[model samples]
Target: MKILIIEDEKDMLQNMQDTLVKQGYIVESASDLDSAISKVGVYDYDCILLDINLPDGSGMDILNFLKKNDKTEGVIIVSARNSLDDRIRGLNTGADDYIAKPFHMAELNARVKALLRRKNFEGSDLLKIGNLCIDSEKHTSTTQHGEMELNRKEFDILTYLATNQDRLVSKSALAEHVWGDHIDQADNFEFIYSQIKNLRKKLKEVKADIEIKAVYGIGYKLTLS
Candidate 1:
């Protein structure tokens, strides 16, 4: 998943990035409101961690902007303002969850996962398609026959496919979701093709009946036998 951390504290920003990256998430950081606004406009993130206090402006402004734009990105307010009213205000302004300052990293991670489940998977951690099972929390995939470990990109591709199972997902959509803003500079989508190939191979090896079908002029779709 992709995440945006809008925090002014350099140390806190790095900590959040490190924690999320270790869990196989793509993370971007912005220390002020301007940068956060710019990044939000150009990039797509599954979730955003916003601090209520920033050097330039209140993080609430960013949340309000996102609401006004009709952006459906998940949002969590992480701030030192532990007052009940502050938390209430954040939620009322469109924040999905609130995390007070001095919180444990584990809790933060849990909250993020919860928010993602609520937004994308109907609050389920395990995604099932026929005999194949994907555990979003463990980042693992298994079939009735056996289980196989997937690399980061492969896992990402599989997850994206599973989420949109039975629907045609365009190559450009995969490129944008997987590679994020970096896809603009890429020369070709060979890497995406390779990832899909590897993912299909792994599933087949495990005797999984799931199939990824190419759409020729379009993209691909995940179909179950």
Candidate 2:
């Protein structure tokens, strides 16, 4: 999944980004409110790790703006404030969860997973389609015939396909979801084609009966036939 970390503390922001990256998430960060707001407006993220105290504005202000813009992205408040009112205010302001400062990174990771599950997978870890099985927590995909390990991007593509099974997902959508802010650096979308090719090949080798069909100029679709 893609995540945005809005934190002013350089060390904290880097640590959180690195941890989430190792956990197989695409992460982008901003240290101030304006940059944070710009990211929230332009991109789609599965979740946002928002700090209440930013360099220029309150984290709650960013939250309010996101809410006002009708963005449904999951948000978790990571703040130093441990007051009851602060926690209550964050939740009331549309944060999915709140983690106070001096928190365990492991626990924060757990909350992120839980929030993603609630938002995307109906609070489940396993994503299944036909004979294929995906363990979101472990970031693994398997078939009844055998097990197949996937690279990070391949796993992300498959997971996305499983989530939107039977729907046509455009190339731009896939690119945005997988690479997030780095898509602009690419000269072309040939990389997307390559990832899909690899994912399809692996599934086929395992005798999995899933199909990823090209929608010609648009994109692709995962069909169970």
Which candidate has the top score in lDDT? 2
Tens digits of per-residue lDDT, candidate 1, 125-213, equal: 98888899898888889987888779988988898888889999988778877777668788778888899888888998998888999
Where does the lowest 10-residue lDDT sum fall in candidate 2? 179-188
**For residues 1-225, could you state the per-residue lDDT of candidate 2 as single tens digits?**
999999999999888988898887999999999999888888888999999998898999988998899998999999999899999999999999999998888988999999999887889998788898888888888887888878888989988877889999988878989989879667778999999999888999898888899998899899895
Candidate 2 displacement at residue 170 in angstroms: 2.2
The numbered model that scores best in TM-score is 2
CA lDDT, every prediction? 0.89, 0.89
Superposition error at 178 for model 1 (Å)? 2.6
Clash pairs for candidate 1? none
Error of 1 at 64 (Å): 2.1
Error of 1 at 185 (Å): 1.4
Q: Name the lDDT of candidate 2.
A: 0.89
Model 2 TM-score, 2 decimals: 0.93
